[model samples]
Target chain A: MIEIKGLVVRYKTVEFKFDDYKFKKNMISIISGRNGTGKTTLLKSLSSLIEYEGNIKVNGEITYNSQEPILFNRSTYENIVYPLRIRNLDLNLYKEKIDKYTRVLSIDHLLNENALKLSSGEKMKVSIIRSIIFNPDIVLLDEPTTHLDLESIVELTTLIKELKNELTFIIVSHNSSFVEELKDEEYRLGGNHVYS
Target chain B: MIIESTMKAVELLFSFDSEIYTIIFLSLAISLLATATASFFGTILGILISISDFKLKRFTKKIVFTFMGIPPVVMGLVVLLLITGPFDGMNLLFTKSAMYIAQTLLVLPIIVGNIIISSEKTQKKILETATTLGANKYHKITLLIKEIKPFILMSVILGFSRALSEVGAVMLVGGNIKNDTRVMTTYIALNNSMGEYSMSIAMGIILLLIAFVLHTLLARFRGDFYD
Candidate 1:
């Protein structure tokens, strides 16, 4: 579980304000907002990537995936293994899991290819898989479906559903359908909340 | 006349003039050393400046940017006076060491400025992701550097090329001493003055070739994570 209070982000002359909120464990929370409305910034603040004036009380580790996938020049497999290596997790223990996820995402074939050469959708899948492999208590994804096609998006949504029981997911998306499919509760920014 | 000189320059290179070869070798060795030293320190400083939030960051950045425009001759003169006066005990004045110092000063600002710009552009997203993941300071820095390695290399190579082709500052400090501090540019100048135009042209050709080869090699050496 995670609780956020008085989260205010100041950038130059503009400021983004977030009301107090609580994110329940094992539930999906989707934040929907327009462009330049601080959706990405709020996500980044939660990730500790940006400075914010707020109080965040959390009990478990957090993993963040950015809006644009950050890829290394190595193979897809190496990219997926990076977080594990950083956390010093046993590679052998996660090998099967990695293979399984890759197969599920249909990226197993691209495992040995240079990650930079992958298509945008493929890269996003790899980034998602890499973040999931870390097994954080909460995974914050900033527009995870941006570059994915319809087919891949469905597959990814399914993957998220499968992992929903094991990890909490907080996703920032502009797509109402995508949010509707995953969100247990939704936060609509820019005005008072009106559920559709 | 230019075409004739260029043709003669090619002939001189083919003939393998010993003096030209020595100058070419010295220029490569000294500039490479200077580039390596400056780039290492510059990149570190750039990253620190980019990541840290401080009141004086803007001021410091402005100063570094200003330093980038410092004329080589003026810089050489400043270095010359410093070495000959307050730093006289070091006896680096009019020596190869003085040349190295001048070249490094000229290139350091450029390298740092470029790297800082590149690092600052990408650091926010990267830092946020890393920090949220419970990554330590060391891990965050390592990841940042790995991500920016390509831009850093570009900055370093730019600095190297700048330092290698420089003449005024090195000449003022190195004194163009024969068989000693004389680099390619200085040697070419000396040869031209002595009516050895062919030898000077040959040195020029060699310098151009070296630059081309270095650029090609750097382009071919893929970055750690360039996607």
Candidate 2:
């Protein structure tokens, strides 16, 4: 579970104050707003990627995958397996999970291809798979649907729904259809204040 | 005269004339070691400064840029004073070690400055992304080093070029002593001053050859990483 109190994020001349809220474990929560409405800012603050004033209490591990998706200059398989390798986890233990995710995303064949050569949508898929492969307690995804096509978006939405039972998700997206499909708690932000 | 010198330069290169070979080897050994040492430590300092945010950040960059433009003659003089000061009794002056120290000091800023610029270009996104992914400081630094390796390679090569082609600093610090401290650049200057045009021109050709080889290697390395 994640709890927030008096969350205030300040940038140059603007400020955003989020209402106190609690996000239950093993659920999908969507934060939606128009462009430049601080949707990404709020998500970043929650993930502790940006500086914020307030208290955020998170129960377990959390990881964030940005919208732009940073990919290493290596093969896709290497990029996906990087976090595990760095953390010294046994690759054999995650082989089944890797197979399932890659097969679902239809990226198993492209695993050996150079990640830098991948198109934006394909790179986004690779990044998403890489981020969640470790199975953190909470995942913050910012604009995950930006480069994804209709088909990939549907596939990702399905995957998120299935995984929500095992971990928590805090997503920032402008896609109404994607939001409608998940149908979890929603927080709408406007200027300096947020509404639930 | 030009044709004769060119032929002599070719013969000296092919036959590996002992005197010329010794000079080339000394020059290469000193310059390569200086470049390697400077690149190892200087680039680490540069990468650390670039990734960090602190109050003195702008001031530190300004200082590095200023040092990058430092005159070689002035650097040589500074080094000469240091060696001839408390360490005067050590007899480091007119020695290859003195030249190595001078050249290292002269090229360190070049290596560090280029690293700072390249790290600014490449490490920002990677650093931020790594932070978001819950990477610790060590992991982030390692990832950053791996990512900007090509730029680092370019910087080290540039430093070597500077060290190899340097004349003013090495001459002042090394005194261009015969056989023991003579390097390619100093040898060329000495021969030219003595009106030994053929030998000077030969050394010039050898220097050009060295530069060409370095550039070709850098190009091949870039291809492997970039492609």
Candidate 3:
């Protein structure tokens, strides 16, 4: 569960004030707004990536996947396993679990390929998988489906739905159909106000 | 006289003249060692300044950037006073050690300035991503170092060139002692003053070659950065 109160984020001369709300645990919440609506800024503030005037109470560890997924100049496998390595988790023990995810996502064939050379959609898939592999308590996805193909989008939402029973997902997307299929709650932002 | 000196310089270079080689060896050895020492500490200083946010952050950066343009002669005079007055019993005055210290001072700012710029450009992006992935401060620093390594290498080459071509500071403390603290630059100065045009011109060629190699290495590192 995550709770926010009196949240104000400012960039240069513009400021955004977010509604005070509590996000339920183990649910997918969609945050939808038109272009240039500070959707990404809100997500980043939640992740503690930017400065904000607010109080946030989070249940557990948080992970943020940016709109454009970042891939290193290494193999796809390494990119997926980076978070685990950072946490000093044993790779061999989790090999089977990682393999299962890769197989399900149809990324097993790309395991040894250079992640930096992969197409945008492929890189986004790898990035999304990497973000959740370590089981963050709250996962923030900003425009996640922007570069993903239809099939990859389906797989992503399916994976999120299956995992939502144990994880809290805060997603920002312009894809209405995808949101309609997966969102448990809608948080709409526009005209300097938040509508829940 | 210029054509005669050129012929003599070519002949001396091919024959590996002992006096010239000794001077060359000392100059290269001192400059390389000084650059290495400066690089070690300067890298830490630069990274700290880049990643940290403090009240004096802007002022500290300003100081470092200003130091990058410090006159070598000014540095030499300060060091000379320190060695002869405060460090009297150390007997460091008029020695290669003094020359090394002076050169290190000259190059440290170059390394630090370059690193600060490189770190500022790269640290934010890498830190944002690393922190989201649960990386600690040490891990983020390592990542920062890896991404800015090409810039560091370029700074080192730049420092080396500056140290190699340095004459004022080394001359002040080294005293240009023959076959002892004498380096290529001081030696060139000495021969030129004594009308030993051939020897001075030969040393000039060696200095130019050193500069050329440093520039080439810098270009190569720049290419690596872009790639």
Q: Residues A93-146, candidate 2, lDDT per residue (tens digit)?
A: 999989888888879899899998899999999999988998889998888999
lDDT of 2 by residue, B51-162 (tens): 9999999999999999888888899999999999988998999998999999999889998899899899888788777776667899999998888888889889888999
* DockQ, every prediction: 0.47, 0.65, 0.61
For each candidate, give its TM-score against the true structure: 0.88, 0.95, 0.91
Give the DockQ-based CAPRI class for model 2.
medium
| TM-score result, candidate 2 | 0.95
Better of 2 and 3 by lDDT: 3
Residue B89 of model 3, lDDT score = 94
Model 2 alpha-carbon miss at residue A71, Å: 1.2
**iRMSD per model?**
2.4, 1.4, 1.3
What is the lDDT of every predicted structure here? 0.84, 0.87, 0.89
Ranking by DockQ: 2, 3, 1
Model 1 misplaced stretches (Cα beyond 4 Å): A6-19, A32-41, A174-177, A187-196, B1-8, B218-227
In terms of lDDT, the best-performing candidate is 3
Q: Candidate 2: count the clashes.
A: 0
The alpha-carbon deviation from the true structure for residue B77 of candidate 1, after best TM-score superposition, in angstroms, is 0.9
Instruction: Name the candidate, 1 or 2, with the larger DockQ value.
Output: 2
For model 1, how does the per-residue alpha-carbon lDDT over A88-154 read when each residue is reduced to its tens digit?
A: 9899999999988988888999999988899999999998998889788999998998998888888
